[model samples]
Target chain A: MQEKIKVTINKKPIEVEQGTTIYKAAKELNIHIPVLCYMNLKDMGIEHNPGGCRMCIVEVEGARNLPPSCVTKCTDGMEIRTNTPRVLNARKTVMELILSDHPFDCLICAKSGTCDLQKMAQDLGIREIPYQGEQSTYREDTSPAIIREIDKCINCRRCETMCNDIQTVGALSGIYRGFEAVVAPAFEQNLEHSPCTYCGQCVAVCPTGALTEVDQTNSVLGALADPRKTVVVQTAPAVRAALGEEFGMKAGTLVTGKMTSALRELGFDYVFDTDFAADLTIMEEGTELLDRLGKHLKGDKDVKLPILTSCCPGWVSFFEHHFPEMKDIPSTARSPQQMFGAIAKNYFAEKIKVKREDMVVVSVMPCVAKKYERSRKEFSVNGDPDVNYSITTRELAHLIKQANIDFHTLDDQDFDQPLGESTGASVIFGTTGGVIEAATRTAYELHTGKKLDKVDFKQLRGMEGIREATVDMDGTQVRIGIAHGLGHARQLLEDIKKGKSQFHAIEIMACPGGCIGGGGQPLHHGNSQILIDRQKALYKEDAGKAIRKSHENPFIQTLYKEYLGEPCGERSHELLHTHYFDRKKRWIKK
Target chain B: MSSVKVELHQKDVDKIKAIAKEHHNEPEELINVLHATQEFFGYLPAEVQEIVGEEMNVSAAKVFGVVTFYSFFTMTPMGRYPISICTGTACYVRGAETVLDEFKRQLNVEVGVTTEDGKFSINCLRCVGACGLAPVVMVGDKTYGRVSPDGVKDIIDEYKDAE
Candidate 1:
């Protein structure tokens, strides 16, 4: 092997392993070599990619031009000047080029005050571009959960990296040439018509306003204006835990009451909780797991092991496109977002004495794919979709701002009764491993005929990629696996494919750290621990709740007796249960 | 695979229906419907756009609007061999621009535009992490290092000979 290269960065001599980039070496010395696309490996979480923004330029003693420290490997006896004037000019020039066509609308952009590119430009003191050119204007793609305005794109390719490399869903990529270059789906197609799933992972990594959650407040207002329409809103469990961030609240602040009041202020007929439907989902899904486990025990060869959670639509659509054969492995749980939609049109419509056709069920979610999920046919019951519209937490923030509501001073309020009541177990559905833990709370107790020692399954919690734990219940050891992020899910699925391990149950969410760290959550910067802080707030909410299990939710118990009849009853199957289909061969283009 | 032959299951059909409802313009579902069709079939066929428009309660024009907005989706089947030239900073400074010019001349196609023969499609990339070998050109699965303008002819010839 070649000897390690010794490089001097800013008068300090450091020995870097061969193949380590200058940025990687500087990072080891705790030197901040200002970067636009150089995210730490841990910050990358699922998508650990190299620099693509070309903002971290550095000068090597013998090199002709500045090298992008992100991808350039260190050489033997190299003297690197990370803060040289030449390096500064190169980096500044790159930043200026990016801003030439960029729309300077940070004040209105959701990514404002928190965007990486904005911070980089501020650091570089790029107040004005030398070349002010006519910018390309794209009609905003105001799809259900995401909005795309291409003019703000720096073409950093971080969104493309995350979309293709991490999610394994190459939804957004670079197309065209020269000044006409842009990031978009093939043929500049609208995202709504694609299998994009509106996961908003692209929006999460976008350094500019080029990729964002589509604004639906105007459409929502239009619906509210029509006297013929009665709007009913459902708030997803994850949205409650993270929506506070938009109102200047700290990450993970539980503003459920405040959110409820805000929705009421928006003139909604009813403020329902998706958590309540989450409880219903657990009841149906937990029973399905138990039934499947029984079948697996009886030597049924067709039984799907490592039953993955389907609460995350990104993960669902991912399996649909790439690993379609594994579709049977995912539980037939139409995520809480969809469950609320199904029940709102059928049950809430009747309670409000409004026709199902006239009632519009709007969902506030911490996911973009919920928009895609709400549009799915299986999510519909009573000849119409249970939910009519889906908006992200960020979109709700925009709506609040558009309505000119004093969000910071809104008094906390409770959700409407009947469909709004939820258990502690349902609340935890916002974070990673929540579905598995919630299911175990009910499944473990129902099978063993004993209460769980503690509702807090610490082993399944946290932001780790793959977590494994074995629990002994009724003299039977239940092996469970929890994985967040699609990359990690791909690894665990590979292990299962190789017959490495057979998990009794597994939980998987497409975005990292499950719903609380969902693609549609408020934008955050480069701090892995910050993501964990957001995740912990969700567990804290679950811990504080009085009823900790889905089976223990009083409203769910009442619903079972009055409407659904049983967890896996005929009515439950018709309204709650769903199925998955395959599409792997179609997308396996090489 | 033809540009527009998609075989969709009930799940895909249902997803399109839900999209139609959410946009309050079942017509809006046409865009996503076309997207789903393209993902399923590798490209959108002209006939399916009409079917998608009808199913989702949107006009074919609206479907076309959606089809032209996002980047990850496509409306045409990719060529047999896809050539992605790196225009990332490191590669560009090392003369990747000349390599791109050579490919454009040789393939008779501009960046992002596939050839009429369907044998090759040339596209540019931000970066591919192989910056050590700057001015790199990727032809299908193979990566050519130290790609000079003159080297472009040999690389395309190598692919042709193999076929």
Candidate 2:
């Protein structure tokens, strides 16, 4: 048994665990303490993440002055007051000061009704600014995953925490002092020039309109209007699970058929499924994994064990920034976004006998990083890149709204044949531990020359940051680990570096909960972790699909037999696989 | 070394020398050495931390975290007359910020920073209750009374030429 600390807040005595933060203790007592920099009930540690934002201040009766409740620990017999007039007045003044430097145009802002700062001001009954000053003038960064409007920042430090502490990317931070303070890359460079993975974790955590996904609706509408281009749209496997929520549906409601119909109503020439490319990815990636395993068994000294899955663009970019040396360990298979883009430009263009340049491939993804992934030069095939424009699931909702399309009344429509057809293995690609589970089913059968007793690896599923499991297949016991979020990724890599991890394969996702809970996903009531209802809905989708395994997808089998011949063929390496260069070598070596 | 002079502690100077020794005699070791020194002290004095960070290829922000996170570090030299103004919530509502403004005007230096003429380093604490004393500003570990805007000049003049 441990000693309990007794603290009195607003005349009510409360007993809490030793070292419990004042903010957390207040929550346990049902005390409403307003916070900007604090997110509670999260699985991660809480030291206010970065403590740069001075928003969580509270008064203690016997103490000398107000302390930030998030950082301050409770002591035995401490007297605290949360709703005192003095604390209330101080908080109001600070909020006023923060808003003074912010932009005044909330009506036109993309974050109009959902911003936390706006909600807090409304709660405090603050309608007008008390002071006037020169707000920092900065042009919007407007990148793939995120848009930077520094003028809207209250310096709540949520973006910084999300980027550095949560994602462990260290791409954004506060530079300079006093009035010159701004969060940005070193020297305030453009995000395109930096090693940002475009995970959009920062955008999701932003309290105001300071950070948001770039609006590509204008470009999409322009392409739709253009007579010269034939616009085709493809949505990823995980997108349907959350798309229904924008129109009063539950978080995990499966809206796949409805979403397809809605796209058709919007005048898209073809509504393809990214799951087609996802199944295609499994074929290419699965083959590559087996080749590497074979090389390792043959005692190839250069063979890489635990070849990390490279399906997630955020994880791929993380490799470029941090572990460039381990780049070869990543499967050469381009993500589903690139796979669809390449085929649309190369194979599909040639088949339809249309000029590749005239075909526009639009990707609707749950990931903001996919937007950035589309812009990279490596994703291009010959003179044309695979993906033309990428939009988040939220942006897709915005598009439907822009067109005045009633999503609820939309009729169910099927995806275009051949490329649109996919398996349950591809459908589960949106959830965490999905890729490993999908690959294991096929790998075990191939290795042992027998069928698997269980298709679902229930042990490996869910949203835990890091999960490990081993299965006995034939004479070989396959060891595997799944890690979500970059902070957990760092731990796994460090463990690997220390020779503590002995695994045949490992799966790493730079963002939490894989693509379904991507940084670009819809923000729901401040609890950004993939809601339980949504996760259940995605698995339900997988359970209902006729074809559960990627290997069993007949279309993928036909694709290999007709065109590619083999997985690691010369043509496969030319198109599907890519290489990486070490960016941090000089920095680490020096 | 030149007319633009800054004074530093002997212990700080010795620690900087030791850091430089580990990084080889390469001149770029200056910034890294200065950051390590600032970790021991409170802040980097003038060219100290900048010189060390540039030498190590580590940016100044990395060096800044060392100074800022650790309560002891300072970028500017400590005031020959150090003044800590308490402008926390209780005092701020009681006009402690106004008192702090007077000190800044009198000493010609902002909070958490120092004056150029070897005179004062002004910093504001989160809180130092003496709410009855309301708006208080401490000068060199000694607490001052309800410091008003009118008393700013007198407080500085007393410390003038004392060093």
Best by TM-score: 2
lDDT of 2 by residue, B1-163 (tens): 1112344455545566667678784645544565566555545653455335444544433444344445555555676678887878878888888888887776667776668876788887877768778678788767887778888788888788574
lDDT of 2: 0.77
> What are the per-residue Cα lDDT tens digits for candidate 1 across A212-287?
7655667788877888998888887788878888888877687888899999988897888888988888998888
Cα lDDT tens digits for candidate 2, A461-572:
9778899998666777778899988889878887777778788788887777777777767885456444566778778988898888888888778867877678768766
Off by over 4 Å in 2: A7-13, A46-67, A75-81, A84-87, A138-144, A498-500, A524-529, A585-590, B1-32, B36-163
Candidate 1 DockQ score?
0.04
**Listed models, DockQ each:** 0.04, 0.05
Candidate 1, which CAPRI tier?
incorrect
Candidate 1 stretches with Cα past 4 Å from truth are A1-33, A41-52, A58-65, A72-90, A103-115, A122-127, A132-148, A175-181, A184-195, A225-229, A381-384, A495-501, A584-590, B1-163
Instruction: Judge candidate 2 at residue A158 and give its lDDT.
Output: 72
Using DockQ as the measure, which candidate wins?
A: 2
TM-score for candidate 2, residues paired by index: 0.79
